[model samples]
Target: MTTTHISPEFTALLQSCGLKHVAIIMDGNRRWAKQKLLPGLVGHKKGVDALRTLVRFGSDHGLQALTVFAFSTENWQRSTEEVGYLMRLFVEALSLELAELHRNNVQIRFIGELSGLPEDLRKLIQSAHTTTATNTGLNLQIATNYGGRQEITQAMQALGNDIAAGKLKPEDITEALIQSKLYTQDLPDLDLLIRTGGESRLSNYLLWQSAYAEFYVTETLWPDFSPAAFEKAVQSFAQRERRYGQ
Candidate 1:
């Protein structure tokens, strides 16, 4: 599906609302394929296409950062064949799209236990990071093998080690310090968290960063979520009043 551009008025509305960082839990790829009576892998491939469109939309719309839940740690429980196919698809997609994304000045970053990925895939991810490190357009963060709880646990562990090594005092630990240890340290906290495919739960996505994020849930599957739909979500967000804790 072709991406539809947002109107200038809507762009102005988003700016007024301070909509910058957006996170997505891209779900329902398998369900979409099942509904179409096709192999699950086909759905994943289509989801990649949707992702490409989303990245372009974010860049064109001047979004600060777009974080996508590409692959969760729990996904490792899927059938071996399906998991293998996904790994291969990641490699293929990155190889095919990295150059174009870099040319568009999108800074690509992967947040997760990247050490657990296959060596070839890790190398390609590293290459994508290095290639787009200096880009200033869109900050594209892909969470592969990531879980919010896991991320927090790792950060706490790091802090503990620092304290044990005399590099930090227990009293020095603060929210800011913990934030600095997260994978998304330098990025802005999520302003909007969207979950496609009708799921209401976060399923262990950016838990900490989404503390006060406005959520937009849709029945549209990941493969079928168009930019126009995203525009609607952001419009909905712009209509809301975020009081943080007020």
Candidate 2:
């Protein structure tokens, strides 16, 4: 597996493109832990740390928004104990990071269903979103219990309901309207998507919004995905000449 690297030419290109947004699938945490003989929860913990580091990277690089696939709706199939640990970890993250996030002007938003989450967790997420809503810094989005299919389905259902209520016409349903209904309604579409862990598949991520995104895959795993590694992904993205099916 070839490791990615940054070059001056690539840096010029990324600067030219003006990095607006970046989305990532924080993959390979479980594999990282299994290789180290560490508990699965330890991997998740490190994954969070990686996320924090990447968030700061995005900030320093002038990116406006970042989205991460933190937990998928399908992830519920994991053992209950692990799932429970993740929920508690999430709460801890909120408690510890919300202030720092606010201090940095990073607005937080959680995509996907929150109704099924623990009442306290749901409250914590809501408070974070509300408190940071006015921030103009990086719009950090975390997808928890999120599935692209479900996101699309829910957006369609919302449109259908609006149409049935004499609020919209079939012809009024434009691409922009549908996009506005997505979890990332106000966020820019993904410009680059980085997935680590050697997984070539999307594994149920942001399919609709990433139609034209540049993909950079690696086997480094999330825990070891350092800032230099992330910069390398950006460098790869900058080297690409996107034609968008032209």
Candidate 3:
């Protein structure tokens, strides 16, 4: 989709409503490349660019946090070659852009089962996290090999283990206690959840944190989801009345 110029009125409206935490389910990379008659990897690379743009935009707009669904646990079922290429691309992107990201004061974090990743890649992610931990800018969280069910299950297991060890009791399992054990404990609950590529399903994203989030689904594919598309989502969010089960 072609990007339109952002208007001052639109920006003011978004700011007025206050979008503190925004999450995105980025979809349609391979499909985008197929439609363009380009390699699938090319679409993935472009998706990375789109992420960079959104991250920068969020930071500039005074957003506190931005979480993106990157590689999901289900994505492992894809072809080995594509998965390998994605891993390599992830490492390359981190190496190439981490310094600029740090300079921009973005705190980089990865949330998922990272133990299954390559040692080199894991080390790089750790290094990036450590290097940017002190940044005061946008809290950038990337969900790689992440699943909502797995996160909740892990939290439950941790709570159970604590109870077994006598460090806690079964009665102590409150909603806050469960949230404290989740990967997103440090961030606020999701304020807005945007999905690209025309898909409307949550697809096992931040299911727990998004209990009251405003959802914006766009037909624009991930690679083609421009800043204007993001602006449009913000506009839609600004117009919503979040009753939060009231």
Candidate 4:
């Protein structure tokens, strides 16, 4: 995929604002397809294309990390057929795009309950992560079957086990400890969170990491979220006064 160009001044502004990590709720794939009277799967495919562009955008613009809400745990509530299609799409997309992403120096990882997915999908996800483990360009985290609440609960459970094993005391548990147990422990806290398709809610995505993230929402659907739109988001973020609760 070709990288999209943004003005150097805009890139400088992003760097000046200390934009390093970004998270996105890629919403409205189905809605985008509906609007075009196409199958929902088509919308998802287009969304994947937009994601490719996003990865390139982040790499080209020097973003340290980019996390996207790809498939949420709650998404299982959708029709069985749709869920199945999404699973297949994941397999297909990863198979097709993993090489290019690795060549671009993007480290790919899938967060969430990996045990619940099909065995084949799990293997593919693992392969993708391993293949790009050494890449140093962009840390790309794809949240599959993930939920913020569930992540916290699991972290607490792990902490409890450690305490039971005498590895840690309850008093040793801090926010930092909990954060370390999260899927994003190695990455920086979210600098910006963008939700496409006009959504205003977090919708169970990176709840802890987003505590101080500047949010940018646009009516543009996920499939149409272009690099220019992302630049606009950064521009919006640049104007904000992030006191971090002062």
Give TM per candidate: 0.96, 0.93, 0.95, 0.97
Taking all chains together, the TM-score of candidate 2 against the true structure is 0.93
RMSD per model, one decimal: 1.5, 3.9, 2.5, 1.1
Better of 2 and 4 by TM-score: 4
Model 4 bad stretches (over 4 Å): none
Q: Which tens-of-lDDT digit does each residue in 1-246 have in candidate 2?
A: 112343555445557876677889999999999999998889999998888877766655556889999889999999999999999999998888898888878899998888878888999999998999999988999999999999999999999999999999999999999999998888877899889898888878997888888889998999999978977888777778988768
Give candidate 3's TM-score.
Answer: 0.95
For lDDT, candidate 1 versus 4, the one ahead is: 4
Off by more than 4 A, model 2:
1-14
Candidate 4 residue-wise lDDT, 52-117, digit = tens:
888888787788999999999999999999999999999998999899899989999999998999
Tens-place lDDT digits, model 3, residues 11-106? 576679988889999999999999999999999999998988877776666678999999999999999999999999889989987998898889
Candidate 1 vs 3: which has more TM-score: 1
Scored against the true structure, residue 199 in model 4 reaches a CA lDDT of 74
Q: Which scores higher on lDDT, 2 or 3?
A: 3
Off by over 4 Å in 1: 1-6
> Cα deviation of 180 in candidate 4 (Å)?
0.8
The per-model lDDT (C-alpha) reads 0.92, 0.85, 0.89, 0.92
Report the error of model 3 at residue 143, Å: 0.3
lDDT of 2 at 65: 87
How many clashes in candidate 4?
A: 0
